[model samples]
Target: MTEGKWDEKFVVFLKKYYWDDILQLANSYPDQRSLEVDFYDLDVFDREIANELLFNPDEVMPSANNALQQIDLPVEKKLIDAKVRFIKIPNKIPNRDLRSKHLLQFVAIEGMIRKATEVRPKVLNAAFQCMRCEHVTMVPQNEIKFVEPVECENETCGRKGPFKILVNQSVFVDAQKLQIQESPENLKGGTQPQSLDVDIEDDLAGLVKPGDRVIINGVLRSHQRTTREGKSPFYDLVLHANSIEYTDLEFDELEITPEEEEEILALSRDPEIYQKVIGSIAPSIYGYEEVKEALSLQLFSGVAKHLPDGSRVRGDIHMLFMGDPGVAKSQLLRYMVKLSPRGVFASGKSASSSGLTAAAVRDDLGDGRWTLEAGALVMADMGIAAVDEMDKMSTEDKSALHEAMEQQTISVAKAGILATLKSRCALLGAANPKYGRFDRYEGIAQQINMPPALISRFDMIFVLLDTPNEDMDSKIAKHILKSHYAGELSEQRKNLPSSTITQEQVDGHMEVIKPVIDPDFLRKYVAYSRRNIFPVMEDDARDHLVKFYMDLRRMGDGKDAPVPVTARQLEALVRLAEASARLRLSNVANMDDAKRTTRIVYSCLRQVGVDPDTGAFDVDVIASGTSKSQRDRIKIVKEIIKSVGEKHPGGKAPLEEVYAEAQNQQIDRQHAEDLIARMRRSGDLIKPDKEHVKVV
Candidate 1:
């Protein structure tokens, strides 16, 4: 109960079970000034000792510190402060679950590190010298504000005069502040995550980086929040970290029950696992089987590789969907948001570069200190980011993703802060065409209001067209009607005072669009697979990819021509195959996985990059706005117009004469007309009148 008795008890408890560990720590002092002791170890030694520290941390912590200082060792070197860190607390609390009752108690909280401030020194003990009598007094600083002696300590000079702080005689320690938020995977439904501020001191400073899933053991303390209106009654809670440890697997943050783990393992062994998972992607949407299948692979991402040359290759697959309206692009995006373990859904229309990556924000959160805020992409690290209306993003905002997509990192150099944050998430973007509808005759880059350079970064680009087909339309109508009916029934049951519909009746109606795997189960399955499975490429799979690339390259070997497919697509194939292998929970990607992925990639290319004139795949079609054939025709038509204008005395070419010249050059009149319109749109030519044009 008393302070000295409490200190003696801590010394006795440490000597009983940790005498050898203390000797080892003393031997390694200064070099290893901290001794990490588990709370369970103390509980096993004496449960009362653990309980006393957890309830009365303020008194017990210093007792443990004194016990460490009192340990005798053979080394002649004086030990610089030694720390006893208590870890492995059995009952760890979530960030959101921390309550007012836990104040001043030793508690363990688990979450992802969202932001961290730079390390700074805080004075702990200040020695002051009074100018009146040269008397010295020591003051211990406890709060955020510095402390100074009020008067001289000598009896002869008890003056209330000024005293100067002895800076050299004062002791200081490294301190850091952190913001930890609950991991996205741990959240259910659409619940926003809760965060708490933490104050780490001494050796614990700078031990963590942003996006790290860590379990921190510390005492919960409260500080009064000071507002512009002056000191408020509300107190803000912050954890004073005593020990920090990284969670072994990112998936560990998502607590998977034993029954759920069994179900996941069993599902992995199913032969129809891939189809079932794809069906579970966006079941409410009528069709887009290919798109849903690709999204399924996105959930089970491939393992990233780090080469010996100090370079890295990202394994995340990036997909872009450019389509007409009412094609369920937004619905699919929202579904992926729930499927991926840490997915973030953001609208490109409202997202800025700083909102998607990282920002150096100056706010009252740190009392005017610049704080680095983690954005959507940084917070969704090792997960998926689904951006709807991707075409609506500003040019500068879209450019921020170039490095995040490829290098899996965001480098910030604003407000005198230079820091790189991890953003290793797969991007799933959906955009609409310029004219609000997909144009099969036009290039994808030309149809969408996005730069060619940004468009080419996507691993696969699919064009979803809303074409009228009798059979497809019937199926879509039935699917939409069933979805609407199910929704109406659910809403009616909720609104009615006394409902005739039983629970069984409601379940039967909802089962029509129910996913093969429940959302919760699918989340756990994806997390387990991502955390445990890292597949390798089999020989046959490797050969399959190699032959596909070689065959596409051979198509460009006829003459001086551009390559049909770049090596980027090859990497995409590998990532897709590995994801397929993960669905079966296999360590090696086989021929079957390779065949499925190859077919998917080939389909994507056919949809977006195929040159209609040559009937061959052309990478330039997607990388730039036009293929070689289209570019050549545009050149020929421009030359003809230029030549016709030179022949004319007025320096203008008539539309009819330009058409005739294009016809003489073996160009179709209709094709020439389209090219002329395109040139006008691009500002390459000026239309003086309906019948005539002038070269710009």
Candidate 2:
């Protein structure tokens, strides 16, 4: 008989007799060729029984026969043990819609996640993507094959997978799941939607074909939803992941050198030079030494690393000022934005939600065609994004922001397109208090129009208040007047040299910057932090304070944020004092380095700690309108005050109450007392001829 005919006959016979058994026996077979030997390649299905039973495994449980009881289906190749059901959650397929994806030019795909569902008998499907070689298939179930399930179809080894399981078990928040019966696994924090586009439908929809690098913008969510009878329990899909995040492309961009980083940082370090740059604009943001330091930390770190989100901008910094107008907060933001490499200024109230993360609806010449544009965050990637009037944005805008700020990405679903885009930018935002002034007595949550959960995400929170002072006002007035008039002067006229520096200058420095320790340095620093910083103990908060010092060292060595040894501890030690030393371009982190970082972090942490009696931290310790750290300090103070009066009330709390407030606010003792004194003198509180005081 001919080889093809012989193979065909073998396949027919196998299908008739052992189709189910072959699938069941798939586990036992060394490889497909084990069965392939007998049937050859006459027909694709010549090995159908083996393919399913061996590879697919719809016929058996486990290894056909085991203690776990590899129960095989009836008429299966392997031995049957008992009745067993492989309960799996279904995943979603790649995008099936094109009109919504809105494919365009110069798009770079960064990442992807699964859209969650909250229906019962939930189908756990494709809300996230895991690559399995050239055969990129999305499995709704968590059990997507990690091993290569097939041979390379081409000359190259095509049938390969990630060699790993990419799981993003970050805190998933699914409210819809809560309404239904949910397992402990589904009940993660915040029912939060995932980020990035995991699936695409077509080329036109920005769904570049499988393996075609693409960027998409869409709301990515992880959820649980009930499926119809006879199907899996939960179903998951990448609902646009949604935004203009996907496009057919990749980027191998250039970077600047360390020398350039050193130069820029050195330039910034000099108050004279730094002041010369923004002196005309931000001359009078007085007394926020820590705030200025934090800003400087972010500024140098961001620029020093030649990339955003580095040590300079850890975990995506976000700030909101709840102060009365007239504070130099806006001025500070303006100057910083201008100093940044790529930044855009927008108001919270007027900025559209979509406009902040993405852009659409541009008319193309007379046609009804719409153009897609990157939003402030997307365009600001690798840079900084500044927003003012933050309280004015709608709740929808705020909700949309929650994911972007944390995950460093955004999803969009409007203008007939669903997509996700990169919004990995430093967020420096400002807002006025609901009372139009710093309400030292209220919860920070209530003062601004944003969620506590969102507020908690910021690395540091500083309140900006228009501290009433005659001398400071005079200085601010004179400075503003000088800047206002100086604005029209040309670069030469001002004798300030150049108004702006080009990216080239920055890049030139990045090119030569050598890695003192490389990424391993970060690992060593993180290890030190975990060991020293994570431990909670009783040592006057000093011995346990190695954590803070270690972190400072890490930040210092990081060139952007730099080294180790001190951050793991919580008590006051170094950072605040050394300040920018950790961000120095040195290859190694020294003791002095750790000390510097410790001082700054300590000050910020102390000012924001809680005071139990007062129900908040000693916020008054850190004055407003100058430093961003004070914002967080105020937030802690507000929470402490709100909770304290409710749980344990006195008509008032004493100076020692600052200690309790510091504890509650996670601040240092010194920070709390400073606030007590400041508030008392300012008359923001009523000190009834004694140590005890209350909000005025």
Candidate 3:
């Protein structure tokens, strides 16, 4: 059909199906310049027109806009430049699947916004004035290159040279560029994700930001590849976006069938559900039942609270594992990533601060304009980010995680771009001890390479020591051998004929190493619980948590006693209890949930927060890198050095004299020497010579 016929059909279709919508648009003109038309509605009206709109949007779009302009309305309410945008396009395609056939075709693609450029005015129509004739001509701009009038339309003057743009008469629209990447959850088998550039104009320019998951309905357009050599035969694809729909809910992408929902509900009702979940996580790996239990709770995280004051308290849990070499820390992290609804795994040795958080990068697709690019944490929003070799990251780079872990947001103010991106994900970080082996006698803050402030933010810190024990070693060896045997048998069965290797024999071997629940089912269960369950703490549960916290605090009531625990631990306990209730699909967190969380918290505290010298629970060891007893002893030693230095000529106390005075004050000689060495390393004391020391 001709363009005029298409316009007439669209006008009739709109009047029949969208008359009320057109009237509403007429009332809200200028502010809302675009009218969204559903593709399904268009299909219902005329199937051929719907098909043409998807295949030849460039031809049909303008005709639809012309039809919209022809609609009858009040004299002052008539729209001249109103747009007709299509939504719910059925031709959904993945980023990697887009090809030449899809170019210029209307399609819907869903992904997380990996990068977005700032909105800027783009010329849509350029009015050129002939310098010689002083006549203006209007030209529509479509391509990347600016267009100018070919020749003057004056009856006598037909000059083609020296045309200048009339700035006041040129039409401009707000335009922005975004790079959308395949959502991490959608990629499988370690496949690298692909991204596509999207151009949005007018009302759609500033509606989305980096880290937002959206489905963009647009027409795919191709641009010739250009380099320093010249334009190449190959072309790059870009989407001309018409509408943006946010998939903001964490589990919106996850689809649970009715049968699967029944199975999930049945699993939640199982009396042994907790044990089954713990056993399902890296079942091939031996022992650390408590650690597995904590990890299970982390999967069904606490409810995020939004206070009336407009501040948000994050419910996502952050956990750290400090262990020796040969442990299964990395394996556990990998398993968690696989089980999460959306996950990203990155190693600190390879990831920079920007790679782990967000970066302001120059976008090649946007003519070298600065854009905000999301990093691992941002991409894993409402999911899990498993970071291995966390200690390998530089202190400067690790500092970037402080805000992301607590506030669940990454604020970037670099390269003339300032933006805050969401990183509302649980962090499962694995680190190696500074000395390559965890020391039970030393504080966790001293053994781990991470800063004390950062370490303190973790809800739980587990120390996996590779201690040599005959019974435990034997068990671990048996488990590893069984896992290998299971794998060998499975491969043999696959290669051999059915008669040679019976299925029952392979199943017997597999049972020893197989997960109690399938990983895929576990992932769906986690997503379901996170989507539906928001457990409220019952009074009994609240009391249980308060009582536990008060009892710990009572241990440090004396004037000189160390603080047993802080309010942070209480908050962590509450989150854990809520997660426990969520795991059961319960609406209320009761005393049982509270008790379970308290037990886990107590165990974690005993491992990392105990003071070696005082043999007491002192959370200061983890929170401040120093126990209260150690701090007091250091203070006494400093006083002794000051008093003894006055008698010396250089005001530097002799090492032997300071130690003697420290011993006289009841501080151990060896402990005093260690304290002095620690102070020297920390820059609080300077060794004037080998035998003398001076306070800085």
TM-score of each: 0.78, 0.39, 0.76
lDDT of 1: 0.85
Candidate 2: regions farther than 4 A off: 1-281, 284-287, 302-315, 359-372, 413-418, 477-582, 589-598, 601-696
In what order do the candidates fall by lDDT, top score first?
A: 3, 1, 2
Clashing residue pairs in all predictions, respectively, total 0, 158, 0
lDDT of 1 by residue, 640-668 (tens): 98999998877789999999889988888
Residue pairs with backbone overlap in model 1: none
Candidate lDDT (C-alpha), each: 0.85, 0.44, 0.89
Tell me the alpha-carbon RMSD of every candidate. 6.0, 21.5, 6.3
Name the top TM-score candidate: 1
Using lDDT as the measure, the top candidate is: 3
**TM-score sort, best first:** 1, 3, 2
